[model samples]
Target: MNLGYILVVDDEPEIRRLVQEILEDEHYKVAVADGAEPARALYQKQRPDLVLLDIWMPGTDGISLLKEWSSGGRPEVPVIMMSGHGTVETAVEATRLGAYDFIEKPLSMGKLLVTVERALAAERMRRENVRLKRAAEPDTFLIGKSALMQRLREDVERIALSESWVLIVGEPGTGRAGAARYVHYHSARSDRPLVEVSLGAVPPPNVAVKLFGAEQGEAITPGSFEQADDGTLVLNDVVELAAATQLQLLHAFQERRFMRVGGREPVPLDARIIAISDLSLPDAVAEGRFREDLYYRLNVVPLRLPPLRDHREDVPELLNLYVDWLVDNERLAYRRFTTGAVNALRHHPWPGNIRELKNVVQRLLILNRGDEITEAEVEQALGGRPRAVDSAPQTLFNLPLREARDLFEKAYLEHHLGRTGGNVAEVARLSEMERTHLYRKLKNLGINPKAVKEP
Candidate 1:
């Protein structure tokens, strides 16, 4: 359980080991460097949340490192300077150099921990203030009170306590990425970075270097895995990874280490992997499109994000959330949803799930001037699109009785499948049929749930 990443730089081996142990006991991911040289390397590699530096050392002291870091405007991370034989002038100099605080050492463990805690808390507050001043919307949290959503949140909380790789499966617009972030925020590594890698977006030719990193001349360019060391790495659309890249990932997982491109030394793989996909992994494995072993590794804990229609009760809350977001980020005029409007949205088949619902809310707020949105306005915004069950093609009416019935059943089942994002169980419940019977009906109707286009 890593609460945060802390770099402890001290020349004395005993002092370094003691500090590392103490910090580790407090659930921080602690990295130790004997002096400034190794300190620079560790800083470049992991970029720890906070750094504890010893001012006096052979060769380049902590002051030089501080100067180097502060030279390029302000440093991203806060640094605390420590010295054994320190004067008021030295402390003031350290303070002037952008050090958060200076401590005279023969260190008091209690004070050291307290100072670290305060510094970290202050830094977090500063970041929040900056974001608010910039009018940056807060990150979307998992919002819902539906039974399915409650269960999902409980599962996420439980899973966050572990270090196992997670596989999240959902529809295209369902909040899989948001769920991953929620897990990371609650995990032991919450204070560390949550790096996201969209596997499908990365060029196939550059996947290896982008993930494992590349060696350029004498400098080593760190990759996502390295950057997310002791943190969480989210691989979005994991199924889009090429076969060769998947194999490489599998090998890295097996060995728990990987070599950078054109580099001989292996870097330890330390980040927890959270992989997300909008497709069925088992089906992909059966089709030989995804690697079985890799899938199993990532499927240590599997979570299925329910489509918006499956949790219609959450629509009102989602509407409020998105509306608040639009107000903060887009500076839209705030408006309340009338009871009728909320009920209408609750019954809407959000084919695109949360993403679609957000878009609708944004559209309503942007296009309407009223302080309260009514049902009629909602209908107008929806362009009178019929519900999934009400959307059977009129062409079916022209066929003979038996053919028309078959065509209607096919279309109906397909629409339900799309609405549920291919979840057969949800389709069964929505259609008021038993699971096995629904499967048979789908087969008889020649409706492949897998073939349905997820919104």
Candidate 2:
């Protein structure tokens, strides 16, 4: 992401100068206006990234001006409403008029910068989403380019050709369900409906009634396996099944025949069952929570999905794929991550994995609008501080101010570089840090901005 060109429109000369200096000091290009009328004029002419409109401006106030701006169809640009003597009504009005967020008077520098950065990140994600929507087919398989992802795709392809039950394991947000869909979609019975049932939702008493049918005469509610005859049945979160249900499921798999509900009539099972779990079912079986026989039955062709951190190499590629498909052929600014943003993203633990990354990108596009996001913005949005490679050690949070600052700084820098495609100048601007200072720190810390370069 690049630095934003901000329009600081205020009546007070001090306020105007202060904002202009602050934005410029942060490496942002500034377009200043002394009043709302002038602000409107400059906004129309230059089309800056964001607007900082004062609530107490002379003539048309912030609320009225916000309304005017929104009606002007420039609502896509994020407008942050600021007020020194603002009432609740005034703030609400500003929001109603399409302001991204409200900033009260005497704002903290960090808070202001973070708000701006978040707004821009959000906008970027939004545009990316639109692009992705336009480019990919509805069922594109393994569009990602990471090594871990390639392995996953190969497994999916291999398993899709077989009737053997597959057990997929991974952390939450690791795309287990998505992978299951791929296997089913490519399988022999691809034309038939894929019946999905969540094992976690089945209680003990209803377990038998769900997997195998009771009987023809019995009033069975019809389990997914029965409904998926000649197709695929997906048992999601199967790890949550109790030992008793596991045993029942195991028997059904071996016999390939079961009665529905209370009916005594036996029906040959025609569906191919594919079960997935976020937890290691083998471990669960050892704990006596899962049935060993069922675990082995489902593990006939087990597949392990890769965690996001292990495949950090694919982050940018996947991001780019999604972006290209989302924004409709780069009509958007098509801003990439700065070096600092990308590095931060790379260093991130990604506890929530790919899903988390997707959500972060979405948030960035909606929040940031037109401007490129910075390290500081990434930190604030992610609740992690930016850090330099050679910075002093500090806990995530600390009792002292210095310690907290250090942690935040590191997190900020990493996220900025990761998200902005590793552009250093853009990162410094978004972070509101002097270019000279940023360069010196990067050099001293031995941080190579190019390390986050796009693949």
Candidate 3:
């Protein structure tokens, strides 16, 4: 029977004793409690592999207690709610409140034991995943140190101390996802599972089913939020979530719940909302695309980050940091960039933000001579003569921060695309960018290689 300890929570003494005896006879350790309050206390002291909860209780019923325990940061313990007078509504409510399954009483002993074993097996698998993740990523702290970065670090620390909703705004390569992660990690809800969804990564037709989530529909699976209760749920590239999806997001924000596709009742969300969008949101609002009200709610604790170009002064520091990381983890010997090469990095525009810079540094360390990088080497590795920007009827010093940076990003990407003859692999290899990062840059710039050829 793969016996394990189980908690039986019912106000009925008879029900509790009968269930305990049935489970104990199967070589299981059973803890009996006459009410929800006692069940919660005992479960907290030593978390059972499974819980049998009753909906009707004196002070706090089973459903209410489950909500309380989930919000209190106890992990997702598999709960099977049992009721003598179970209706469709009550069963649905129990499921929504995070019960694994609901059983109508006149309890079937064999069926109950089978469900307990299955729940325990699933619980074991979930705990194993958590343990493996902890082992792999012991130091999950945010990685970056610059003036803008320091400001972000301070923001995360401050927000972590509070439970306010967070809205992160930045360009594609500006680390919005990474920023969202930091907030969750430092917050009180760090121990719960993290649910991440990218607005641009999924198909529009299926976006709602994935984010707000779908019920066990006639077809399709449950969504991210359904799986991420009492934790952090991040929506990345939120700009791509069309008007209808934005409305759904706003509803989820305002109601603390959402009815999944083809589902009737609203599934309450206990997960914290942290959404990110690239580009200026004001433009979207002005275009009558994004809802103003939704904007206001999400902008509660706005975290605006400067792109890599604005913080060019931090380039040398980033280089040194990456080199140290490569040495420590990858066992690569430390490499140093020459003063001229560092100077070149500062002058060129980094459109892809920190991601592009990081990739370039790693490539130099691995593919080229790690020691003593030069200006000529930087120019050769990442093409587009800085002279082009200098000679474009505009002086680099005279151009505004954003304009100059955009030119650099566009020019750099165009130059690389040309160098590879629209070959992404060669472009990523020569430019030292990850394929995904490079594609993100292409999408952000609205560049289509086929269109450039046709035009």
Best by TM-score: 1
Question: What ranges in model 2 sit over 4 Å off?
Answer: 1-144, 213-220, 325-335, 386-455
User: Evaluated with lDDT, which candidate comes out highest?
Assistant: 1
Task: Estimate, for each residue in 3-122, the C-alpha lDDT of model 3 and write its tens digit.
Answer: 677889998878888888888888998899998656755753444667898888888777787776555243357998898888899888777777888888888988898888888777
Q: What does candidate 1's lDDT look like per residue over 365-427, in tens digits?
A: 988987999898887776555353343343334433433454466657877788888999999
Worst 10 residues of 1 by lDDT: 391-400
Estimate candidate 3's RMSD in Å. 12.8
Error of 2 at 383 (Å): 1.0
Error of 1 at 188 (Å): 2.4
User: Of 1 and 3, which scores higher on lDDT?
Assistant: 1
Task: Let me know the TM-score candidate 2 reaches against the reference structure.
Answer: 0.52
Q: Which residue window of length 10 is worst by lDDT in model 3?
A: 387-396
| Superposed model 3: Cα runs more than 4 Å off | 1-147, 216-220, 331-333, 384-409, 412-455
- What ordering of candidates by lDDT runs from best to worst? 1, 3, 2
- What's the TM for model 1? 0.65
Q: What lDDT does each candidate get?
A: 0.78, 0.67, 0.70
Candidate 2 residue lDDT tens string, 393-437: 323332234224433454466667777889889999999999977
